[model samples]
Target: MKNLIRTFALVTALLLPVAAAHATVLTETGLAESKVAASETYRLNVPTEKAVATTQVRLVIPAGVAVTRFQVMPGFTRTVETNADGLVTEVTWRGRIAPMEYARFFFQARNPEQAGTLSWKVYQTYADGSVVAWDDTDPDNTPASKTTVK
Candidate 1:
């Protein structure tokens, strides 16, 4: 009985962090300033340097929400990627986002669990084949924003 109890406790402790990662948002500076509006339409915008024709963008969505709609600004192409389950893994919002330029996407997020915090990570692929990963931490050493969503 003692061993079983100890094993259960150890397992629970190990799983707690993994569970929290699902809810915790890691916002890294992708290329510019970004923000999330709590309105019915969850809006996101990332302003960063332009990507070469061969560049790829890796935009990750927060675990708690679903991306109902996604669009990219004109002058560039875009693609949406999904997991085998058909769930969106990442939306490759492409196009040469002009240096000091901004790109945006919209989504309809449902918070049935009434979760508090919403977050995700984003990575950028440059035209030269370089990669920039932003999981909500400042990659370029920029400050990240967090909020208490009601």
Candidate 2:
């Protein structure tokens, strides 16, 4: 019996990492519009699971999209980086974020002479340096999101 219990425990431990890799929260909403013009602002709202004094928040701007501006409200520090192509590949916000607290991130950009769904992964960093990626199909990662252009 002792040997059997030990074996089961080992198996569970081995599977734990795999489970964590799969452990992601995704807060995604359907795109409200199929067409967004070149001149407009798009918005998305995301919340933290176990709110951490946020150390940083990173947003990736995919190819074919131009980011003109990124804004964070009252209590956050932000950084924006553009790649050689002059497109924003990363936008990071640094600050404290309490668990269950939500923040809105907005950006103005123009589509790169093209039109379609523009998608990218976003990551949230906790005060402890732990990171939560808003990816995968986990509903917990799902956040309020929208697209707009005029």
Candidate 3:
């Protein structure tokens, strides 16, 4: 009994930090690995991590990826910024994600022809007027989501 109890404690101590480091408020799915030049649909899962509701979310499209379409999320308004060549550079969703609730936004885009990593920067704003930028390169810092083109 003593040995089992000690092992359990040791395992918990070793795994807690790893779990914490990977805790993300905004997670993305789909398009993890896709063929070059393929049109893929991706989903961004945003959770209200704070006590207040999330009021807005902005996503900065990385170079080489051209976002062509977006899915309408209920209660949210979608907006975009275009470049000179008529390409989308940024996408923003305005709505209220109540405390302890989550929302998912979907979009379709064409992957670049070249094989590389596309890092997506996202900013989450709370109703209290605070913003969380998911642009870090480190995992523990709420880094932006990345997709690899094969």
Q: How accurate is candidate 2 locally (lDDT)?
A: 0.59
Q: For this target, which candidate reaches the highest TM-score against the unseen true structure?
A: 3
lDDT per residue (tens digit) for residues 1-150 in model 3: 999999999999998754443213222343367778988887777778789999999988889888888887889999899999999999899999998787888888888989998778889999999988888755566777777788
Ranking by TM-score: 3, 2, 1
Error (Å) of candidate 3 at residue 114 is 0.4
Q: In angstroms, give how far residue 36 of model 2 lies from its true place.
A: 5.0
Where is model 1 poorest over a 10-residue stretch in terms of lDDT?
Answer: 22-31
| TM-scores for the candidates | 0.55, 0.63, 0.81
Candidate 2 TM-score versus the reference: 0.63
RMSD of 2: 9.3
In order, what lDDT does every prediction score? 0.51, 0.59, 0.80
